[model samples]
Target: MISLPLLSHAISSCNGPCRDLNDCDGQLICINGKCNDDPDVGTHICGKNPPPPPSGGRGSGCSQYGTLTCGGSAYPTYKCSPPVTSSTAAKLTNNDFSEGGDGGGPSSCDGKYHSNSERIVALSTGWFANSSRCGKMIKITAKNGRSVMAKVVDECDSMQGCDAEHAYQPPCKNNIVDGSDAVWSALGLDKNVGIVGVTWSMA
Candidate 1:
């Protein structure tokens, strides 16, 4: 149930501060504390106000987000995600920071490969804030009531991917906290589940 006045206000104020997705209008979404047009609005699946697909085309895969294909596989893409809060809700995904692993090149913050034994993470593009959060630590809390402190060592890019630098992976969802194995171990999570819901805040 959205109010017309709020929608009008949001439509009139692109880039204005927003508390969440409801504060945005039309195809706009909240990102990094502001409302902006979703870059993948029409292109991605499960997007708000999406236009109809081509008449005879196959449906978009996995009714959650857009997809990018590489090496004969489709990976999800997200141009905008939920706004950040003090205890920001995010998706925690696994990452291997060791050299020759799926993490690809060295970390963006320190240009080094960390061990899976280290508690580290890669934030999404917006929360990474152009490396502003680099080298900092965050507290992650899982649904099972376990928590751990992990360092921010890299960025799970939200804007660009499916290339050599990104290990041919798609752009990350804007609400990702790509954590190392040590972080999962500390939280007593089964990394085999792949992605899980979590809340995080600066530590």
Candidate 2:
């Protein structure tokens, strides 16, 4: 098993020299010590330092998270997401997972649509980690002092989007937790608010 020291070494090697996934070009991901086009390698081989939160609206303090243009609209997207913390910070956004819903298609993990009343979520690409967290339960805590348990059902793509599969929506941010209506209601948050700050952890 890889130790913390080895993980740290991998991260430093990626940033200082050219050894890990960050140094790879194109769709290749790091596995062991070589770059390969295997999605199953997962993303835990390297640690990503969190970029400071954007202080203003679009285009402000968004250099870390690059931009993508889709349907005449530019969206901010991240190549790398923040490392998980004790209470990993994230942005909770509304999502519809039922058939013919705004979530686009069947869930990535199970390939089935879930009801809005189900406490399910679609995590950002990095956290999704090639479906590594599929079917897992997580605890989400909102600022309103409410919390709920949600199951991981899909991935909110952070790398690529603006396609039919993605419902032409822009790529998701690296720290997003796209939750269903039940999650919001359980947290005592109004879905009309759209997005809100929250923290979560594996349950």
Give the per-residue lDDT digits (tens) of candidate 2, residues 1-203. Answer: 74433444343232233356554432345556555443442222234543455665343322344445557766666655677766988999999999988888899999999999999999998889889999999999999888999999999998767767788788998889999999999999999999999999999
Clashes counted in candidate 2 amount to 0
Error of 1 at 14 (Å): 21
Error of 2 at 117 (Å): 0.9
- Give the best candidate by TM-score: 2
The list of candidate 1 runs beyond 4 A from truth reads: 1-81
Q: Each candidate's lDDT (Cα)? A: 0.76, 0.77
* Residue range 1-203, candidate 1, lDDT tens digits: 85433443354236766767556543346788777765644342223565443343233221233444446655555444455667888999999998988988899999999999999999987788889999998999999999999999999987667667788777787789999999999999999999999999998
Clashing pairs in 2: none
Return the lDDT, model 1, position 140.
98
